[model samples]
Target: NAGVTQTPKFRILKIGQSMTLQCTQDMNHNYMYWYRQDPGMGLKLIYYSVGAGITDKGEVPNGYNVSRSTTEDFPLRLELAAPSQTSVYFCASSYSSGGHEQYFGPGTRLTVT
Candidate 1:
């Protein structure tokens, strides 16, 4: 299994442009999440999906959206990117929230101007 994979690794954006950061996991996990880690801070969840066809917003869901059309993929869509959105985006997946350590991809570093 590929665990998880994220595209671009790094990107720069202007004030109001938009982009989508791709994330995929081959572990067939039931839980997936998109989290942003700002400099010197804990990760804030942007969105989460418990399973295919089921998704919910998380703590810091603003300027972001997510969709889980399949068990292996969960991509984060950033609309109207802002400088505040500049941070490292990590795609993580777990078998269960209580008993599993989340597996993270290499991360996509986005710089919104």
Candidate 2:
């Protein structure tokens, strides 16, 4: 199975543009997450869902939104993009929330101008 995959490996947006970073895992993991990594900072959780139809904000969900319509898909939406949102975004999943069990996607590099 293809562990985890993300689309549009790279993107550039204007100040107010909007986009959705797509994530899908064929592993059928129940726990999924969206995280952002700045230049030299550790990853910060943006949103997460324990299962389909149950979503919650993470450490940095202010300018982002997420939906889990199925166990394999977790899409992260960036509304009214800002420079502060410029960073590398990652999509991860795990059988449980155990950090060690988590698997990450290739990552999407986004730039806001």
Candidate 3:
């Protein structure tokens, strides 16, 4: 099984263009998260979902949106792409939030110009 997967490993978009980054996990995890990592910094949480139909914004949720409609899929959407949104996005999943180990996807590199 694919522990976690993200589509379109790399993407380039215009300033106004928009796209959806797909994330899926086959581990049946209850906690899912979206994080963005800048060129030379740590990962910043953008959004998280405890389970289906439950979602919350994280530290850096601006310009992005996420919806978790199933136990396996959590997709991040960029409504109006901007240059500042350029970063490497990662999708992670874990069984618990209390210091449990998390599984991460390969990541999606997005470039907005």
Candidate 4:
């Protein structure tokens, strides 16, 4: 199974532009998360969903939004692209949050010019 997948491996956007970063999992995981990794910094959670129709804000959710309408897809939407939002984005999924292993997708590198 394709554990987790992210589309548009790389993207470039101008200020004020908007885009959607797609993420999908074939593992039927119950937990999914979005995270951003800035240069020289650890990954910071942007948003997460425990299951379908249940979503929550993470460490950094400003300028972004997410929805979990199914167990296989969780997409991240950037309302207004900003330079500060330029970073590598990762999508991960886990069957459970209780010490279970999470499968991560190949990161999507975004640059805002």
lDDT (C-alpha, whole model) for all candidates? 0.93, 0.94, 0.96, 0.96
Structure candidate 2, residue pairs in collision: none
Compared with the true structure, what per-residue lDDT tens digits does model 1 show for residues 1-88? Answer: 7789999899999999999999999998999999999987989998999999999999999889899999999999988999999999
Would you give me the overall lDDT of model 3?
A: 0.96
**Each candidate's TM vs. the true structure?**
0.96, 0.96, 0.98, 0.98
> How much is 46 displaced in model 4, in angstroms?
0.5
Stretches > 4 Å off in candidate 2: none
Q: Looking at model 3, which ten-residue stretch has the lowest summed lDDT?
A: 33-42
Candidate 4, 44-95: lDDT as tens digits: 9999999999999999999999999999999999989999999999999999
Clash count (model 3, backbone only) = 0
Q: What is the C-alpha RMSD of each candidate to the true structure, in Å?
A: 0.9, 1.0, 0.6, 0.6
Residue pairs in collision within model 4 = none
Provide the lDDT at 48 for model 3.
97
TM-score of model 4 (CA atoms): 0.98
Better of 1 and 3 by TM-score: 3
User: Candidate 3 clashing pairs?
Assistant: none
Q: For candidate 2, write residues 13-60 as lDDT tens digits.
A: 999999999999999899999999997799999999999999999998
Give the candidate order by descending lDDT.
Answer: 3, 4, 2, 1
